[model samples]
Target: MSPHDLGRIYRSEIEEQPAALERLLEHDAEIASIAAALQSRGPRLIRMVGHGSSDNAASYGVYAFGLLPHWTAMRDSITLTVHYDSPLDLSNSVAIGLSQSGRTPDVVEYLVRARRSGAFTIAITNDPASDLASAAEATIPLEAGSEQAVAATKTYTNTLAALVLLAAHLAGEGARIADGVRRAAEQMAESIPAFARDAEALALPFSYTGRMFVIGRGVEFATAREIALKLLETCRVAAEPLTATDLAHGPVAALDPLFPVWAIASPDATLPAVQEAAQRIRETGATVVASGTAAGAVQGVQYTLPVPAPDEPLLSPLLSVVPGQLFAGALARVRGLDPDAPHGLSKVTLAL
Candidate 1:
């Protein structure tokens, strides 16, 4: 509880996740209004755009938008939209811009272009007056307050929840979505202490690991990517994010019995495929650590690091990442690195 703790800022933000999610739920009406407006537009796809943690948040939206009563979604090419200014037809599309500070020039520029191209643009941000919010037609506030950590924690989770709610509204699953959010908040609060123990133990193994792969499938794929990025930024680990299919395709060759491989196996449609991939990776003699509620179900993995189960399958990416965030912060502290102030980085960067 000392302020002098190395990763205190990052830890505090991670610990505030439940309250941040609660703030999001408080804005349900606003989110619903925007979702209704978007539905009226009859958009066929959601084009998500952001950079850094925000970009990873967009990946969650991709999964959210694809949930049953399915809708297509894709990441907008920031280079094409911002730098090259390529003319794109977006009349039948919805574009969502995500930013913590809401000041990233490239993200703002892309939102501007998407709006001009006839897309119903929306910005999810912590700062209401931020440039990205101004550029979009509507805004979803993250309500994460001020995050002093160099690495994003609260904002990422809050933004993910907002995207999920938006998706649920679009799919006409209002009541279920509200219940799911409440359950998710409770789980997040309870998981903190349990996962803290797991993270503390896992840090010892990761401290000695030179490189690793973080794998997930479906919505959890984006969860893996965010975890890998945190490990890389905070712990200085050469962590690569890959999907189960990608590992099976060719990357499987790199793992050895001594090699470190982390798998996120949640309870979802992709579980069988991801577990199958985890079993195969374990056969390669690599040290496989399976994470998620179904960690015990993934036979052959050397470690089963269980996290709190998600309330809804579509919310897997948001809940499954809790343990990974704890692991990254703890692992960085174990490695004598300052997780809150990682080198060669800032809280925000202007891609343009």
Candidate 2:
């Protein structure tokens, strides 16, 4: 592929993220209505299901719903519902399914079962008319439009925005949540163009890298996972996602000289621990690429790719993942791969 043509589609979608988020927030009134219904039910638990990038969104949602609404949340085991067909009692709980296409069979089936078991089911998807949406009582459309790239970029961020809006409404802090979401989108609008150029330059040095680790803590851990998946799919890099706290347990032993580590951290409680791990990993002669607002604060990282983010840590993931998406596309282009079409993958997976 020509240098000018490489990753064109994927990069374009990454740049569309800000508009996608703005569109999602335009449906704030609908999200507020859903929250009112949820609040009225006084649900005690939230069970979320998704596959791939949607699952990573669910991982982030687990924390957001828990922290904001003060409800117990779990990344539900889809296997139990899809494979084992185990009877589940979801009374007084909310079940949410996240999917870009909203056509994942497993997700649709799980929501169908949840609704049957007395749970109020919701679908967060780009397609409100998709099967997953039909299986649910309510749908929060991502409004991300059609993503040409096989790997998700705008849809993932929009999913996060939708979740944040819903969680904010449920928590009863309408103004604050709206401000946070709006600010985060504005930051992305201001920074993404520069971030894309920077990511392309950054990818040059690591184009030959075979494997690496992407680390984060708390809600940002989901950012790590999403980044790793992007690199794996777009650049064909074996990027492993790990929590910074878990690095000391066993994963740190894998580090070696020239090994690349992407440490994603925000200015939150998890910052100190993530910074500590980055410094420790730096001692191994591994190159650390620090990302997010805490990038400058972290010591010993070989490269810093700081991103503009919100004051609230939960909202940071929406911004933090931008660098990852850019890096993935840039690296793919540098490595002579077309990020728009990776081998053996489609835009949507109809998981059984």
Candidate 3:
């Protein structure tokens, strides 16, 4: 609220994530109930839809639902309904919509259509009273409280936590997953300050850069996409996100010394392949910045950002995304831009 606090709101939201996640975990009973109701429907497939950071969270949901419940999950293109008015057969499917404000028109409309098509619809959002909540048969509150910054921080992480919690319950791994989520919150509480400071320092050198790439694999690929969005929202950087394998297939050809790459790799099955990609990128003389538990383990990284190591690799996104948020805030400050007030953006975007 003061001159010195100009850029602190976004960082404060970043710091509030541990508490936000812990708060969401307290609603385990409600999440379990929703999971039970969903399971009762005997869904044949899973469909999720959102925009921007919510979309990234949906991407994570696709992986979470598949890995935990062994369910077939896919991201639904809302444009199919909003733009083309195509008939969709979503019967025997569970459709989910994730919106921080719960007012994203496209997501709400998608859920409305899915419900009409006989799918069991669920909404994950911060506000239980939002239109998105009204569109779904069930709503899981994000419990992230109020996020004033235009770029999502606590709400985004809370969205991820909610999706994982619901998926874990659906998979019958509720207790174990709950424990992992709590432990991840504890780790985040202990490490977020250092993560913020370190990420800020790590991003200072690249403040003037116009573009870069953020890479990861598996669930962490969602982490990469969210981080890239943060950088774009707060710092006005064209931070493109790609999976490590996707990078190698063709995008790697565009890398050079002037470009920087932030490779987010956790301690999981995807680590070795991500490390290989980082090594290859380094060989191209590009500046390679890495994050996550296995960040330091990656060879040829110019800088390693700190992230709390989660109890399981599946919960890694809870910890892995902190540094990228801080990095974006710091980069905005260094460039004399207000991280909370990007040139033309709002807290809630109503897209048709």
Q: What does each candidate score in C-alpha RMSD?
A: 1.7, 1.1, 1.3
Cα lDDT listed for each candidate? 0.86, 0.89, 0.89
Runs of candidate 2 exceeding 4 Å displacement: none
Ten contiguous residues with the weakest lDDT in model 1 = 1-10
- TM-score-superior candidate, 1 or 2: 2
As a whole number from 0 to 100, the lDDT of residue 159 in candidate 2 is 86
TM-score of each: 0.96, 0.98, 0.97
Error of 1 at 348 (Å): 0.8
lDDT of 1 by residue, 120-194 (tens): 999999998999899989999999888999989889999888888888888888668867987888888988988
TM-score, predicted candidate 2 vs. hidden true structure: 0.98
Which residue pairs does candidate 3 place in steric collision? none
